[model samples]
Target: MLPSPLAAAAPPLPPQSSDEDFFSTASTSTSSDSKPRSPPPTLPQIPIVWPEAGALTASWVADLMQAFEWASKALPPSEFPSVLPVAVFDKLVLTASKILHKEPNCVRIDENSELNSDCRVVVVGDVHGQLHDVLFLLRDAGFPADDRFFVFNGDYVDRGAWGLEVFLLLLAWKVLMPHRVFLLRGNHESKYCTSVYGFEKEVLVKYGDNGKHVYRKCLGCFEGLPLASIIAGQVYTAHGGLFRGTIITPSKRSKKKNRKVVHNPKVDSLILGSFEELAKARRSVLDPPWEGQNLIPGDILWSDPSMTPGLSPNIERGIGLLYGPDCTEEFLKKFNLKLIIRSHEGPDARDKRPDLGGMNVGYTIDHIVESGKLITLFSAPDYPQFQATEERYKNKGAYIVLEPPNFDTPMFHSFEAVTPRPKVNPYYDFEDVIDSDEELDLVSMVTDSGLQQPAV
Candidate 1:
């Protein structure tokens, strides 16, 4: 059996508390508008055995799939269902965090490894807690094995009913096969984002009294997750696209009354950070403060590729930078890489770009510079699982499969949402989950600090 990093404990029965008690004011509670809900059926006691490396065979995965199926079919809980034992959950998170903590901010999957040289790599995008969908994706994409590798580009939790289940299952796989499976950090993985979104509430409802401890453990695991991965030394993959270097210069502008002395950063003056720099990044920070040296981690997790021509601060998100075609080319050319694969946007961001076929396709090539292409992949279909009928995007989800040898060319596999997902009550008010960073008001932070946003 794999060594347990934490002692297993029985899951304590949670004290009766309304869902509102867990979430912040920013999130509208689902309990407020809906009819009075019943407490979830208690899960019967099941003997828990921590996974052994040898025991983590296909049957182990199948058992996990079966347990998740039960959890998915059950009604949404006002509190955690305790499907995963507290001890098992603790040991899983602690073990996974320990493994992740040893990895650098940027993980390299090179072709030099004899074992991986002929393996196929499947790169998955954001899976925002859609357990059923993830299961389908795994079945469709084929499970990770000695000859088939998997790279999940973060955003494992939040937005859906099964975030914790989805996250833990992936953690099991990570512990089972660390070299073949890579988990990169997504913007939603942060403590701040989970608190603002539904993950914190999901954990609380799922784990009850132990929810706080589970959630804290989740944050620790998030801290340990690597920021990005380089596949075959040719493709760069991250949840967010690109980042700016350590250099940030205050622009010289004449003082004029009423005209804000913006810290206009010169596009040329900004540097696209190197993999060496990415390796040196302090990714353990739970929520990077998005200023000074902290900007690198925040940018790596939050930045988006722009159709524009230069790198500039992502004003809309209030964190990370919006990089353009030129920036993509620069980054790729500098690293001698071929493509950039990232995932953070969903239908909302996809539909805005009608030219890119909108939400019809799961992946989009946002920028095609001379060096290579910058692709955006979103794997959560009909995203934001619980939404008003009129607002649904009805989008398909996708994953990219790269063959052995070069691993440069990407083959896209897009699939529609699984039919008839188990009916679960919404956790957070749909209206309250705004995508922009304005909720944090970090733009005001820029002005307050007297740093004018550099013109693109």
Candidate 2:
């Protein structure tokens, strides 16, 4: 059963225009044959009606307004600048209980009030630009002004076609309700995925030569995102799991030298270096030639899922970290955490391994690891291709709802199954198949329902 938080002090906001409908007109402007038309005009300030007590502070509101204004002025008219609707902005205020002023480095939730002993936390998984799925999951999990806290894993972009829409929607939510939502940076939230996938292409198509501006804005936003979050100091969550050797320590090396260290657990050490230093080190670790069987802790930020158990046999291989159930349990014990929620895997895979440690430990898996971590949840679901039904797709989509632990209750929830679609094989070679009868037969068997064949 879903855990409901104590009565929220704030009231709910009115419904707003759906993001899909708002962007429908802009998305359909892809007529290559037509004359090159100018971009859309700058977006006007969405007059949001926020509750008086819950309204964002003047400075915070101003900073966001300035960003919107700058984004309007800097962005060209031909490109559709108004991605977020005004109504969505207004709804953000209705969901918060209280806001606080604290060190900008850490996200402090409910600092004004004592920690709500019965706080309910909803953790979501990777969105991968599946806006519709996200909405569905939110509806299923109870969203839009719910009193529960939320945390989104990462991988907000790339792979899916609607990456821009996903980014804009979440950014708008962040602006309107900074406390309710938190974003974490996934490995894909960097320059590499943006350049190769539909993310960069979408920006170019929407903004023309100014696409880089959008990309840079996204990267800048990602830079400020936290790598991980501790929920109630019991549930440790991040886009990726902890590195095997990531222990907290003090280092006296120069800032440059210290920046090269793989996993400095002390949060203060990260502040010693510039964004450039972090980016350079991140790039170096992500790229090849490092000598190790398992991935360097830094490299784990971008590593894909490896469900296999034990350290890899090849010592010099860069196949990424592979954590079995035991490793997860060990990490949780070391950190004094009951569970770990991560988002690097797809929904289907998540469904299969919802309870990573079998026994209750706090390792909850929210899919979107790239977004920030705090009191927010993601609604995005698996993209169209990932929605396939074959055995592999059976466990593809679903998020989790965690009720505060009780004497007889567990700390986390199990994975739920999502509707699956037909699986597509990426490695299948259609061109070479026509020459082989066996290949043709196999293809026919997969695509056709009634093909009589002799038994072996």
Backbone collision count in every prediction? 7, 48
Give the alpha carbon lDDT tens digit for every residue of 31-121 in model 1: 2221222222134343335666533544554455555655566535643344567887877778788889998888888754433655788
RMSD of 1: 10.6
User: Model 2, 1-456: lDDT tens per residue?
Assistant: 232121132223234343322221221111122122112223334333344675444343433333332243344423343433233332442232112112132233442322365555666656766544443344345442335566667677765545665565555455454555666556566554455445666666555555676566556565555555556656655565544343234466654455444442232222112222322233222222133211332334433333453432212122234454445555555545565566564433334454432111112332212222211122233222333434433232445555545211223322222222112222223233221111123223323433232110
Error of 2 at 338 (Å): 0.9
Per-prediction TM-score to the true structure, in the order listed: 0.81, 0.53
Error of 2 at 352 (Å): 13
lDDT values of the candidates? Answer: 0.72, 0.41
